[model samples]
Every structure is written in C-alpha cells, then in structure tokens.
Target chain A: MRSEIIITLVGMGIVTYLTRVLFIVGMKGDRLPPFVVRWLSYVPVAVLTAIICPMIAAPEKHLNLTYDNPYLVAGILTTIIAVATKNLVITVIGGMGVILLLKFLVG
Target chain B: MSGPTFDRRQIWKGFAESVPVMVSVFAFGLVYGVLAVQSGLTVLEAFLSCVIVLAGMSQFASLPLFAAGISPLTIIGTTFIINMRHLIMGASIAGKFTERGLFGKAAASYFLIDESFAMATAYAEKKKGGSVRDYMIGSGIAVFAAWNIGTILGALFGNFLGDPKEFGLDFAAAAAFIGLLVPQIRGKGDILVLLIAAALSVGAYLTFEGSWYILITGITASLAGALVTRDEK
Candidate 1:
C-alpha cells in the first residue's frame, strides 16, 4: 500500500507538471487560435463554479439543501458577501464565522 | 537598460497579492491533510501528496477513490481530468513568457497553481517592465509553502485537531474559490454559464463517482459560454 501510494503521487506530480508546461514548451512562438483563446477564457470561471457549487449544495457526499447543513447556509451567505464586498478575506471570515456560530449553537 | 534578471519588486508584488488568498489556501490544505489521514493515508503520504502533486482539487478528488481501494491508474486518470484546466491556464499565460529561456520557463511552470496563475496573468497584462516569470514563481512559492506547511500540521496533528468540517474549515476551499469566481463574472452570458456549470456540477456530484463532475461541468459550461458569446462576437 505504501509503495503504491508513493508511485501514484509521483506519477500524478509528473503528469500535472507536464500538462502545465505543455503549451509553454510546445507553442513557444505560435499564436493560439482565437476560438481556443476564447475557450480558455471561460475555463477558470467554469472550473471554479464546478468546484465550488457542488461543495455548497452537497457537502457531505450527498445533496443536502436543508437549513441544518451549515455549509449550505454559510455558502449562500458567503456568496452574497462575496458579491457585495468583493474581498476574499472578508468573505472567508464571514463564511467561517457564520458556520462556526451555527456549529456552537446547534451543538 | 539593465540586463534581464529576476525582479525583486515583482516577486514582492506577487507575494503581497497572494497574501489575501493564502489563508484560505492554507485552511484548504489543512482540510485536505485531515481528510487524507482520515481516509487511511499516513502522515508522510499526505504530506508528500501536498508537496508533489500540488494540485489541490485533484488531490481532494482522489482521496475517496484511494479509500475505495481503486487502482492507481484510474485514480491518476481522474486527477488528470480534474487538472486539465492547467493546460488551458498554461496556454493562456504562455505568450507572456516568450522571452524566458527553457530552464526559466520550466521553473516558472513548476509552481503554477490556480491562485498564482490568476495573480501572474493579471500582473503580466498590467505591469510596466517586470518579469511575469518571477511574479508567478513568487506567487507559486508562497502558495506552495503555505499549502505544504498547512498539510504537515494537519497530517501530524490531525488526530489532535479534531474534524475540520466541524469548525467550518472544510468550506474554506469552496469559499476561497467563490471569492475568485465572483470577480470574473462579466456578463449575462457569464452568469448563465455559471448557473449551468453549478447545476451540472451538483448533478454530477449526486449522480457520479469521484470528481468527474468537475470535468463534465467544465466542458458543458465552457460550451455554453462559447454558444452564448457567439452572438457578441
């Protein structure tokens, strides 16, 4: 198990690094297609939403939209604060504060 | 003019910009470490994963599969898909590094995670004469150090630290990603794409295994963006 885990981690690291440097190495002097650049522009926002939303709506490996789910409540609150403040520090603090408060009260 | 060399100011700028999000990244890293240990990984294994793989989303995504005793090949494939965005990220930033030699580019690329890419790209577009390579390397190193240190603390003391989710630390990554996502919402098309991605991501999570939802949501949402923006173009 230990050796297998090591191999897996090393393999994953190499693959990740290779993918990161792929275009830098191969497309040294080439211009990316307009459509491809446009496509890439959307990747960050798309990937971020994909990663964040499910986390809020289904944190415990299942869809839990109920009020009891602190993550759901905090997530929604954080979204609102994020849009309002546009500050990462405040948003995290606000979200974590609310969830911690809820945890203490609920417990 | 001075010869080409790494700019200390650019590095400082990168380090300063990353400070805002580093806390959350650290917290996120802590969550991963705790979860990795809980999923049967030793402290060393979890720590190495943070330092080596260095891709937060893919690392988190792989944990469940590892716990399930899945084959390493399949797990790697899943991580590969989850991290495919880095390819696009690399492509987007490739133009800015044209002057960097192969060794410099390789070193700069080694640490290009999402937060660093965001900061580095913004700096590249706006800076007067600084090295984008140094800025990204700085940002990446800062995040890299924070993440690995957090992981070590989490792994070594995870048994003593209790459950991260209980204190809402587990949501740190989601919240951090949200902060990053909000500023990028530019138009009605972007909003629609976000909604579609969110819905699809949740659907994928509920229906599928591992982190395939990320890939599915990413592809479908990007396609939606392409279609919606087609009229604007």
Candidate 2:
C-alpha cells in the first residue's frame, strides 16, 4: 500500500511537471495554426463528453445511484437553467435547490 | 518605468473570487477525501494528493482503478490523455500572456482548470482587463485552499458519512460536466462529433472492460470531428 502511494504520488508529480513543461518548451503560446485553433475550441466540449461517457455508462459502478437520482434531476435542471440564463451561479443554485428539494421529498 | 506594486491588491482580489470556488472545490474534495482512504491511501497521502495534483476530475477518475492495482503506466497514460485539454487551454491563454515571462506562465498553468479557463476566456471576450487576471488568481487560490481544507476534513470524518452513496456525489461529476457542456453544445457538427465520441467510447468500454481504450477512440473521434469542421472555416 505504501509503495502504491509513493509510486502514484511520484507519477502524479511527474505528469504535472511534464504537462506544463512540454507547452512551455514548445512556446505553444505563439499563435497556433488556425487549423489547430479551430480544433482547440472543440477540445473542451469534446473532452468533456469523453469524461461524461464513463460515468453515465456505469452509473452503478463506483459512485452510487438509486432509482431516484436527485443529482441527475438537478443536473438536467442545471443544464437547462445554464443555457436559458447563461449564468453559472443561477445554474448551480438551481441544481442545488433541486437536489435539496428532492432530498426533502424523498427522505 | 516605476511600476507601482499592486501585488497586495491582486492577492486580495484573488482571495475574493476564491471563496465560491472554494465552496465547489471543497464539496468535491470531501468526496475525494473519503474515496482516497477507501482506495488504500492514508489520510496524509490523500490530503497531499489534493495539494499536489489539484485536478478533481483526473484525481477521481484515477482512484477506483488505483485501488484495483492498475499499473502506474496505465494510470499515467490514462490521466494524461484525459487531461489533454490542458494543452489546448494553456495554448490559448499563452497567446495572450506570453509577455508575462516563463515563470508566470508556469505558475498560471499550475492552477489552470476548466473553471479558470472558462472564466478567463469569458472575461477576455467581454474585454475586461484587470478583473480577468484577478478573477483567475482569486479562483485559483480559493480552489487550492478549499481543496486542502476539504481533504483534511474529509479524511477525518469521511467514514462517518457511512456512505457517500446516500448523498449521490456520484452524480456531481456528470452534473458538473453537463452544467458546462449543455451551454456550449451548438451546431450539427458539434452534436455529430459528440455522438461519435460517445458511441465509440461506449463501444470501447464494453469490449475492453476499462476506460483506457476509450481515450484512443475519443481522441480519434475528436480528430475526425476537427477534420469535418475544417471546411467551414
């Protein structure tokens, strides 16, 4: 267990350093290829979907999910408000409210 | 050129924005704290992991696999691909702040995350000057502090929560991602790319039985998405 922690920690440290160093060395800040810049805008949205996939695919795996997943409900509500209002705080609060309401109703 | 040192003021503004970010990061930190211990890490290690990596999604993604004795190589590779967005983000911001010097860029990159990038980009697009930089500082410091504190608190009392399953922090990640994604989801090209990546990722998961292969398919899909979007330019 100790070896695992040490190894993971060191690996993490290296990854963090390398990630930053590669960009710094490449002087990636200079105007990117228009081809790449156009692509970059999509990266966040694309990567996010990638991250989202594993979670939705295995809802019952690590993080727990029940028949009534308030978090899920609140998330849907949050997405709606975020788009409609284009406000992060409003969306977050709305989601929190949804969750709180669900908790009260369910519990 | 005598420049007034506004360092103190900058620090203050940084602290101010950090407060709310602290709230969100701390909430996630609470989950990480408990989960790290459950994954065979000690309290000290768990708290420090937050301090060091400072990336919530990557940390959480790596945990369960870590517990199952996945190879460090796989962990590192998976996390790097998952976080490849950082390369794009850092690239975009670098164009604006290169004159700030190498050290400043490195320092800035350390705290770079989805929230910070979104905040910075929006601020720039709005043509706000100092507040853009100040907001980043504020959010970063706040997230850092809140994360550390949350880890310690979670480490101490996380077990008492009995099971986070009850609260369903599970949904928080997806919720957070959706909270960000749905706002930005636009155009048929965007929808098509997302669907391709989604389908391929799900297929990979079923066949490979792990999230590892999903990275390859996801990136390939993203490249294809970019190619299809090119003619529009």
Candidate 3:
C-alpha cells in the first residue's frame, strides 16, 4: 500500500476503535444516575429507528412514499411480518422474498 | 474485578442469532470491497480496512474522499464523524459490563459494531440474565468473519457478482433492524419513541448532508422518551 493509504487506514482505525471503546472503557464498573440509565436504555430503539427510516423511505437517496417504491412496500410488509412473527430469520427471508417479488412484478 | 467468564453456550447463542444479519453484512462488505478496489485502493488496503477499521459505513464513506485525493486528515476526520454513533452504542451497553474488568471491557469494545450491539441488546431484553458480554463477543466474531471473507471474495471476483441491490440484498440490513426493533417495543412509551425517532430521522435525513442525523435523532428521541415515561420502582 502507498504511504498515504497506510496513514489514512491507520488513522481511521485508531479513531474508529476509540469511538467503540471510549465509553465502555471509561464507564466500566461505574454506576450512573437512574435517569441517565433510562436515557441510555432508549438508545437502541432510537438509533435503530433513525437508521432504518431513512433507508426504507428513500432507497434511491430521494423520498418516494408511493407504491412504485419497492423498498417502501417491502419495508412496511417486512415490519408487519417482524411484528407478527418476531422471528429474525423469517422476517429476513420474507423481506428479501417480498422485495424480489415486487421488483419482478413492477419491472 | 473478575474477568468475564467466556460461556460457550451464550457465545454459541450469540453466533446463531447473528446469522440472519450476517447476510447483509456480507453483502455490504462485498459491495465495499468492489467499491474500494474500483476507487483505486489495492486489495491489501481494502482488506486491511476491514480487519482494522471494521466500520463498514465509514470505510465506504472514506473511499470517495480518498479517491478524490482529499488529504489523509480530512478522510480520517470524516470517518470519525461517521462513526460517532458508536459512542452512544458503547455507553448504552457499558452498564452491562460493570462486572467485567478493564481487560474484558477493552476486549469487548472491539466487537461493538451496530449489528452486534443491536443483537446483544435485543437478546438482553428478551432473556432476564446471561453473559451479554460473551454474547456480544460471539456475535461480533461471527460478523467479523462474514465481513472479511466477503471482502476477500468480492475483491477477488467482484465484477461477476453484479449489483447487490438487484437481488434485494440491500434490504437485508433494514429488515434485520426492523426485526430487532419490533421485539423491544412493549408499551405506548416505546411506540412513541419509535414514532418520534422515525419522523425526525426521515426529516433530518432529507435535510442534512452527512450521517449526523443518526446521532441527532437518537439522542433527541431517547431523551424525549426518558422524560415522558414514568419511573418504575
């Protein structure tokens, strides 16, 4: 690898590792206030929602809420399947199947 | 403090639960590998990023910047910003590792990717007690293996694989996230948090240019949740 590539990768690695490790290392064995714990408890749901909504709403980088958008159609149906079954494997399989079917039909 | 006991059963459970998400991670890694090589990175560099950086999205984000001849510091800074969400994920799971010593916590931190974090969190929510630290490690290893293997294969033969989107591989991550998120919802409060986060996330995603929407929406919605819900004894 080139010197610049090496430096960039190493730098990126260091910072990324820091981000992953900082809080866990810093707060180990330390108790926090109850409200702080409560806030942290909500992090997973909030963060996952934040990540998922945009991707499904705009699979092509622009919002398309119509039925023509296979991602929207599949995302909604997959979510329903997820809620009804609560099985990750089935949800994923059903999701991929629905999207492929939608693409084949819509195309 | 005692080190975390590496429970084989919990680890196996973690690995098994992670299998569903691994499909998407592998797909993304393949896509990343192809893009990295296409962007002028050598196969070694692409593989090295997967092994060391281990953050797929930031790695993907950095490729364009690196190809554009941006300064190394700029690329690395953008990477830091893109991965800032890890801080919240780490803090959220930190409480679970209180019994573990620094060495255990430090070791576990390397495996704190988004998928593993979500899986471990969901697992913890479902099961009243177990070694989440060990579970996280197991799931992390499973994801790490899938990613690296996919990168190697993709870099080697990416041209023939075609677009991952054509097969709807891109939806795998969204589907996995949905599956994990749905089980965590119990009451009206959880539903409220989900709605607020989703609305703000979509709005901020449309409005903003970078990955800051995740951190912005995550913190704001979670804080709103904390304030609105009554404290249980």
Question: Which lDDT tens digits does candidate 3 get at residues A1-107?
Answer: 69889988999999999988998888755555677666666766787788789988986778899998888999999999998998765786688788999989999
Query: Could you give candidate 1's per-residue lDDT for residues B1-233 as a string of tens digits?
Result: 55446667877888888997788788777766766776678888998998889998778767766776877876776676657778777877887874657777887778789999998888888856677888898899889988898888777766665666765666655666677689889877678788888888898889987667777777778777876675343
In model 3, pairs of residues that clash are none
Error of 3 at A52 (Å): 2.2
Residues B46-120 of candidate 2 have per-residue lDDT tens digits of 877777777766676667667667777777766665566666666665555423455555566676766766666
- Give the clash total for candidate 2: 1
Candidate 3 regions with alpha-carbon error over 4 angstroms: A1-16, A23-29, A59-63, A84-90, B1-50, B53-160, B183-188, B231-233
- Candidate 3 fnat reads 0.77
In terms of lDDT, the poorest run of 10 residues in model 3 chain B is B158-167
* CAPRI verdict (incorrect, acceptable, medium, high) for model 1: acceptable
- Ordering by TM-score: 1, 2, 3
Report per-candidate TM-score of chain A alone. 0.70, 0.55, 0.72
Q: Please state how well chain A of candidate 2 matches the true chain A, as a TM-score.
A: 0.55
Writing each residue's lDDT as its tens digit, candidate 3 over B65-173 gives 6665877876777677557668778877887753557777888889999899999998778765888888998999999989998887767764454565775656755
Candidate number with greatest DockQ: 1
TM-score of each: 0.71, 0.69, 0.60
Better of 2 and 3 by TM-score: 2
